[model samples]
Target: MSIKVFLKRVLIITMIILIIISALYIFQDKQRFTKKTGTINFSTKTEEKNILVNKNGEWENFFVKGVNLGASKPGYFPNEYGVTKEDYLRWFNLIAEMNANTIRVYTILKPEFYEALYEFNKDRENPLYIIHGMWVNDNSIEETMNAYDDRIIKNMKRDITSLIDVVHGNAYIPQNSTHASGKYKYDISQYVLGFILGIEWEGYFVYGTDLFNEEITSYDGEYLKLEEGTPFEAFLAQVGDYAVEYESEKYEEQRIIAFANWPPTDPLIQPYEPEDYNDIAQIDVDKIKGTEKFETGMFASYHIYPNYPNFLNMEPEYTEFIDDEGKNNSYRAYLKKINNHHEIPVIVTEFGVPSSRGIAHFDSTRGFDQGNLSENEQAEIIPELYEDIVKENMAGAIVFSWQDEWFKTSWNTNDLIDTERTAYWLDEQTNEQFYGLLSFDTGEEHVKSYPDGNFSEWENSKAIINDDEAKLYMDSDESYIYFKLNIKDLDLENDSVYIPIDVTPNSGAYKSSLFGLEFDRGVDFIIEIKGKENSRVYIHDYYDYLRYRAKSLPSIQKFTEERTKDMDNFNYIYQYLMENVDIYIKETKQKLIKDEQIFESGKLIYGNGNPNSDEYNSLADFFIVGDEIEIRIPWQLLNFYDPSKQKVAGDYCVEGLNPKPIRISKIYSGINVKRGEELVYSSNLQSYSWKEWNTPSYHERLKPAYYSVQKMFEDE
Candidate 1:
C-alpha cells in the first residue's frame, strides 16, 4: 500500500477507535471497585436521655424501625392556624399514638417550635430527634419567614446554648439541617451541623460553577438566568477563610444526607460522577464516610421516585447512557450507588408520586393524574418504596411534606378565586388519601396508627429475603397491583417489603365526593406473592402483575474489545460513553429579569446571532413555565475509573478505579429566565431578521427531523 494511503487509514482508525471506547464507557454500567457495599449502622447512647443523638448505638437501635408521622400524609398547619402549644402537643401525641418512633418537622419558622415540641414530648418515655426545618426558601421570603429566619438563627444558637446550659446532664446534641438556601451556605456556617444540599437543585448543576468554562451552560456562563451567578461559586470565593475549618478538618461522618434524582429528566447526569449529584449528594466523591465512624443516631437521606418515562420528552436513546429505562427507572443501580457511599443508616428524605393538581403536566396527552395517583396506586407504589428504603438497612423515609398544595394559586386565580382555588384545592385535597397513613381531621382524631408499637420494626417489615436465588417482579392493573406471594404461607405481618413499583394518576379535576380511600379511580393493590421458607422459593412481591418494573436498563454489548492493546484506539468505549452518559447536559440559567429570547411564529431562528422580524415566525429560546432539557455528552471524557496508585493505610494501592457516576441538577430549571434568554437571542438572531436562520423551515418543524437532537417539542 502507498504511504499516503496508510497514513489516511491510520487517522480514520484512530478516530473510530476513540469513538468506540467512549461508547463502551458510557453505554456499559459496570464497576471496577474492589470495595464492598458498606452500610452505616446506628444506635443511641441511651434511650432514657431527652437528647437522642449521643452518637452511639442508641440512635441505631431505636431508629432501626420507626415511621415519620408526617411522611405519607403530613398535617398542614397553615399560617392561619398558628402553632400554639396545644397544636404542637396534639401533633406529637397523635404521632405517638400511631406507634411511630420518629417525627420529622417540615420547614419551621424558629427554634421555638422545636423547643415547644421538645417540651411537649419531655414527659413521654419515648424520645425523638427533630429532623429540623426543611426548604429555607430564598426565592421569595415572606414576613413570617423573615421573622422565622431570625428566629431560626437565634433559636438554633439558643437551642444549642440551652442544651449546654440546663439539661439534666451533659450530652451531645444531634444537630442536622436539610437546607436549600444555596446563597446562604455562608449564612449557615454559623450552625453546628453542616447543611445537606443535592447540587442539582439549581438547574441540576453537578458541581458549583467552572470559573474557566465561558459557555452559556458552564458555571457562571451567560446561559444562567436565575440569580445571576451561582451561590456556590460565590460561596467558594469565601472558602479561603474557611480553608482552615474546611481543609484541616477531615470529611467526617456528618448527619447531612443527600440523594440523587432518579430517571432525571435532564440527560446530563450519571451515577459515577460526584458532580452528578442532581438529587442525591455525591457522598462517595465527597468522602463523607470517615475511617472514624459514627457510633449511632446517624442517618443518610435517600430520595425515592418511581419511573416516569413519559415525563421526559426525549428519545430513549438520549438517556440510553445514563439509565436504561430512559429517565423512568427506580432500579438497583441507585441502591448500589448509595450503598457504597455511606456507613450511616439511609433515610428517604423525599418520596411521593406527583398529584394531579399543581404538578406541572409534561405530556399534554398524559394528564395531571400521574401526579394524582389513586390511594390504591399510592398504597401500591409508596409502601414498596418505603420497604426498599428500609431493606437497604435505612433508618426510614420522610415523605415530601406533611401537607402541600397539589394545585395552587396562579395570576389568573384573581379572575375566579372561589372556582379556581376551590377546584384546585379540591383536586389536591382528594390526593391526601393516597399517602394517607391514617385519617387526620382537624375536628376528628386518628383511630389506628403506628406511634410506638402499632407498627412492626424493620425486621418485621421484611416480606422478601435478599439472597442468591431471588428473582421476582411487581405488576399492576389500572388500580390494583397483586403480588401472589410466590412463596406461600410466608408471614408478612411482621415482614418488611422491597416492592419496586411506581404509580401516577391521570391529570384532571375530580373529587371523590368525600375524603377517604374508598372512591372510584382510587388505586387498590394486593400482593399475590409466593415463596417457601422450606424449599425456599420466595415471592418478593405479593401481587402477581401489580409490581414495579426495572427502571434502569442493563448494559448491553455483543462483544468486548481490548483497550489495553492501544489506548488511542478506544473509539468503541468513547462512543458508548457519549451515547449513554449524561455528562453532556450543560445547565444554563437565564435570569427571568435579566436576559430574554423569543421569536414570533413567522420569525426564523439561528445561532449566528442576527435576529430580525422579516422572516422568522417562531422563537426558540424562551423559558415558559415547566421547561426541561434533554442533553447528551461523553462519559469517559469526564474521567471515570482512574486507577492511580495511592497509599491507603501505608499500603500502595490502585485506587479511583470504581464506578464514577455522572450528574444531573436536583433544583428546578427556570422558565422565565429561559424565556428571557430565548427572547434576547431571538431579538438578535438572523433567523428572526433575515428569515433564513439554521434556517428553521417548515421541514425543520418535523419531529425527528427537527434538529440533531431526537426531541419532540411539546409544551405540557
Candidate 2:
C-alpha cells in the first residue's frame, strides 16, 4: 500500500465521521419528538357563516362561530383574587395568539376603583370603554344591605357613559324594584354571586327557553305530595304554589328595575306595567318610573346562571325530570320560551363546576371530581353544554371566570400572586380552573367539550417544551428584526432605527435577544418592536374589538333557541381579538400594499377557515378569520375603522387584572412600512419605555410633553 493512497483514504473516512456526528446532533435537537394532537382535517367551502337580521327581525344564521367574555371578572387589581395589568395583558396577548375574538365587558360605573385605574391607564390618545349595564345583580340588594349605605352602588353608577353599554344581571327573577322602580331592572348582576356565579354555570340553557319558568307536568302524575285529593289535583295545587312563589320572588328583582334608570331616555323599563297585571300576587306592579335617564346604553338586559340546582330548585320536579328527549333537548325547549317572551338579548353570563380540589360557588361541597371525573371528561362536558345555547341564537354568553389558580380560592396564605386561598385560586367552587379553554395553571391542552370534541390546541409552533426545558425557534420569510425585550436586567444598548435581527424562512436562523424563560416583572417582559418581525409572547389581547366586532349580526330569523348559548371557540376568539386589536392595529397601516408578503406567503386564510388547505401558512390566522372575509384585514378595520375614534373605541378593552383604563388607539396605531406588518405602540399606559424606545433626550433629562407625534410614534 502506498503512502499517498493510505492518506487519501484516511481523510475520506474522517469526513464521513464528521458528517454522521453533525446529523446526529441536529436530529437530537430539532424536535425529533414533535407530537401535536394531530390536527383537525375537516374543511368547509363557504368562507363565512354569519348571523344577520332578516326581514322579520329574526336572527339569520348560517352557522358561523364567535366568542363573548362572560363580562363578570371582579374589578379589583393588585388586590386578592386577581391579576395585574401585565398578567392580564399577557392573557389577552395569548388570546390573540390563539386566534379568537369578542369580549363581553361590563359597562358598569365604579368611580372609586376607577381613580387608580385612570391614573395608571387612562389617556386621551389612549381610550377606555364604559359598558352601561351590569352583567349581573349590582351586589344583590341583600349583599348591598349587608355591605354599606348603598353609596358604593350609586358611585359605581359612574362607570357608565351613555354609549353602547348593555346591562347583565342574574337575580332570581331578573328584577330590581328598589333601584329601577316597580318594574323589572335587568341591569344589575347578582350582588354576590349566587348559585349561578358561585357555582358551576348553568349548563343546560337554550335561547328563548324559559330557563326558570318551565311549566312542568310529571308523567308519573305525582305533584304536590301536599294536600289530599288525587295526583292530578295535587299537581294543580303545586303549579299554583310555584306560580305564586315565582311571582313574589320576581317582584324583588323588579324593584331594582324600578330604581335604576332604564330604556336609555325612558324613565323605566316597564313604564306601563298593566294596571291589572300590577296586582298579580307577589309582583309589585304599581310603582311608576324611577330614574328617567339611562346614562348607560343599557336598554333591557337579563342573565341566567345555568347548572345543577338553580333550575332544580325552581321546579323541584326537575330533579328527576327527563323528557322522552335527552337533557339537551328538554332543557333547551324551556330556554327557548324564556328568550322568546323576554324579547331581549340575554346572556348566560355565568356558569361553571368545581373539582374536589377546589370549591366553585355552585357546590361548596363539590368533591374531587378532579379525582372522580377525568379532566378530559370535564373538558368535554363544558363545550357541549355551552355550545348548545349558542346554537339557540340568543344574544351572547360569558363563562364565569376567575384566574386559573386563585380563581375559586387561594391555596397559599402569604403573597397575593402565590395563593390557592385567593379568590383567583381554583377550587371545587371554580372546578379547579377548567373554566378557560387553556388551563393557565397546568398549561396543558384540553379539548372543548362538544361537537368538534376532537378540537386541538393551537401551538406557538416554534416553541417546543421538551422535558423540563423549552426550545424555541423563530422564522420569517421576509425581513430582519431588531427585537428588544424591555427588561431592566439585560445589557441592551441598540437604539437604532434600522432593525438588525436577521429573519429567514427557517426557524433556527435567529436567536433570542432578551429575557429568559421565566420572567418576574412586567417592565422586564415587554417585547419592544423595530425588527422586520420578532419573537412574540403568547399573549391573549382581548380588548380590541370585543364590543362591536359584529362580524355577523344574524337576522332575527337566524336566531332561534338552538342558535346561541355557551359557545367556547367563538367566545375565546372574540375576547382575544378585542383585547389585542389595539396591539395589532398599532402596527397595521392604512397604506395598502400589493402583497402582504409574510401573511400571504404564510398562505394565511382570514375568512371562515377550512381545516383542509393543501399548502398554507398560519393555522391561527386561517381558523379565526372574519366570516365575510376570505383573507382578513385586521379586526380594527373589519369591526371599526382604519384608525378612527370608533375603531379605537371598538378595540379598547380593560380587564380587572389592571383595573386601569385601556387606551386602544393613542398608544398603538401605525403601519410597519418595511414588512407590510402592523406594530402596536403603547408607550403611555404605565411605563417609561417611551423614552427608551424613542430615545427622546428630554425623556431622561426633562418631562415628556403632554402630547406629541414624536412621543406617540416613538413607542413603536
Candidate 3:
C-alpha cells in the first residue's frame, strides 16, 4: 500500500469527525432556542385548601396575587370594549412589573388581548397566568323572570363554548353590539389558570327562579352533580359540568372552576341580618361537587367589599372580632367565616375600596367605606385587606380593577346623570368610576389647572367678567370647571360671595328666596361661599333630584311636589336620605328594621386640590389665596347630565320627573357680594361656552395605590 493513499484515508476520517461534532452542537443550540420561545404546557390544580401549580417540573403552592382587567378606556363603555392591543401589551407589562402573577378578566375580550398575552409570555421565564370569565345576560333573567328560560340557557351554553374555543385559539365570533368578537389564532390555554362563571346573582332572581321551577331540584351531569340544591345552584352545576366536559373531550385539558358569588347570595345564615339580605335566597357552592372524571377541582369565588349590604357593619360577631393588630376588623371577621364555611379553596376575586370624593356607603368600624378615601388611604387599606385574606388561609386575592372606568354609575347618583354619556367626561363624585389603581386624567398633555391656590395655570385663560370689582377667569377639563376669582379688597372672614350659574335654557329660578338674592338670568345652581366651613351648593327646587326620586316611590309620592309654591325658591341639595322602616317578612313572620342615615351631599371642603400637595383633598371644591380664590367644581355637582355635549338637568316638574335630555350651548354666570342676607354689589351675567368634544383628551397615570400594592405583592 502507498503512503499517500493512507494519509488520504486519515484526512477523510478527520473531516467526518469534525462534521459530526458541528452537527451535534447545532442540534443542541436549536433545542435551547425552542425551550425559550415555544409554548409552555402549564398545569394548575386545586388541592384541599390551596392552588398547586406545576413549575419547573415540580408542583408547588401558588398564591395568586392578581388584578382584574376590565375592557374599557376613558371614553368608552365596557360593552364597547375599546381597549386595543397596545393597551393590553402595556398593561400586561405594568401588571407583571407590579409582581402580579395573574390577571382575571370578566369576559372574553377581543382577539388582541389573547395575542398580546401569548406574545408577552412566550419568552419570559415566569409567565403571567389568566383566569377567564363567562358573562351572563342579566337583562334576560330580569325580563323573563326565569333563569331556565330558553334564551338565557342557550346564551349561557353558547358563551361557554365560545370561551373554550377562544382560549384554544380556534374561534371566529362575529362582531356584535354587546360583546367582543373576532378571530382568535393564539393558543393561550396553557397559561389559563381557571374559569370563573357567571356574575353576582341578584337575590330576587335566585328566589324567583327557584319559585318558578319548583320541580328542578338537582343536576346530574358527567363531570359535576348536585345532590340537593336550589334551582340556581342546579343551573350553576350544569354549566360547570358542561365546561369541564367540553374542555376534556375537545382538548383533553382541565383547570380550576369557580362560580361568582357575593354576600347577598351566600348560603350562610345571619340571624342579625335582615331577612331580605340573608334569608331570601341562598347559593350554596358546596352542593355543586365535581366527579372523579374532573381532574381539576373547584374553588369558592366572591366579590366582597368591606362596606356593603349593612350586615358587615351590623353583625355583632363580625364587628366584635379582633385581628392580629388588636383592632376590630369586621372585614377580616367576615373573611374568616367564609373561609371556615367553604370546603374548597377560597378566592376573593373582587375586593377593594374606591378612592373617590363622593361616598355611597359608610363603614363605621373599619373606615373602609365605598368611597371618600384619598389615594394614600386606598394604598394603606388594600394591603391590609390582602393581609386578612392571607391570614385566613384563603387561596388567592384579586384586586377589583386595574384602571378607572369613567362610565360607571352609582346607585345614589345614577338617577341624576345621563347614563349614556357618562363615559365622555370624568365625574369625581361618582364612586364606582374611581375604583382602579390606574387613573385617566384630563388634558391632552397635562392638567389644565390644579386648584392648589396657584394662578400660573390660568395665565392663558380668558376672563369672562373683567371689571373694576373683580376679574373672573374660567377654565375647564374633563373632571372640573375651574374658576379663578380676583376680587378687589376681598374679605373671606366677613364678606360672603354668591355665584349663580345658569346651565340649562329652561327651568331654574330667577331669584333665590333662601338667600334673598336675585339673578339676571334663571340659574339652576348657586355657589354660596360664606366661610371655610359654611360653603355649599344650592339647587333650584324645580330641578332637584330628590323630587325625581320621590316621584318614583308610590308611598312618598306626595313629597314630589314643590316645597314652595313660588317658582323662584332655592334649597340646599341635601343627600338622598334612606331610612329602614319596619317591614314584616311573610316567610319568617317577623318584623325587622335595617340601618339608615343621612349625609350632607352638597357641603364643600376647603383644602389643596392638587395631586402634588401633601394635604391634597380630592373633595376640595375651593381654595383661597390672598385676594385670588381658586375654585374647581365637578361637572355633576352643577347638574350636568352630560357636559361633553353641554347637557344639563331640565325642569323635572315640567319634564314629568323622568330624564329629559336637555342640551345647552353656553352657561351664564355672575358674581355678587353680600353681608348677612343683604346684597352689597352684583355683576352682570356672563355667558361661557366650549366646543363639544367627541373624543376626550386624557393621559394614563398609575395611582399611589399601585406602588404600595406592588411592594406588598413583591414581598409575597
- Overall lDDT per candidate, in order of appearance: 0.27, 0.24, 0.82
Q: Compute the lDDT for candidate 2.
A: 0.24
**Which regions of candidate 3 deviate over 4 angstroms?**
1-42, 275-279, 548-565, 569-596, 675-680
Per-residue lDDT of candidate 3, residues 198-236 (tens digit): 998888888888999989999999989999888989989
Error of 1 at 58 (Å): 5.9
Report the C-alpha lDDT of model 2 over 563-655, residue by residue, as the tens digit: 222111121111111100111111233222121111011112222212123232211221211111011212111221212111112212222
Error of 3 at 657 (Å): 3.0
Which consecutive 10 residues in model 2 have the weakest lDDT in total? 694-703
What local lDDT does model 1 show for residue 535? 12
Better of 1 and 2 by lDDT: 1
Give me the runs in candidate 2 sitting further than 4 Å from their true place.
1-85, 97-100, 106-153, 159-305, 313-330, 354-373, 402-434, 442-716
Query: What is the Cα-based lDDT of residue 323 in candidate 3?
Result: 90
Candidates 1 and 3, the one with greater lDDT: 3
What is the alpha-carbon lDDT for the whole of candidate 1?
A: 0.27
After superposition, which runs of candidate 1 have C-alpha atoms over 4 Å from their true positions? Answer: 1-81, 110-112, 140-200, 204-268, 271-285, 288-299, 307-333, 341-345, 354-369, 403-425, 429-716
Candidate number achieving the greatest TM-score relative to the actual structure? 3
Rank order by lDDT, top first?
Answer: 3, 1, 2
Candidates in order, TM-scores: namely 0.36, 0.30, 0.89
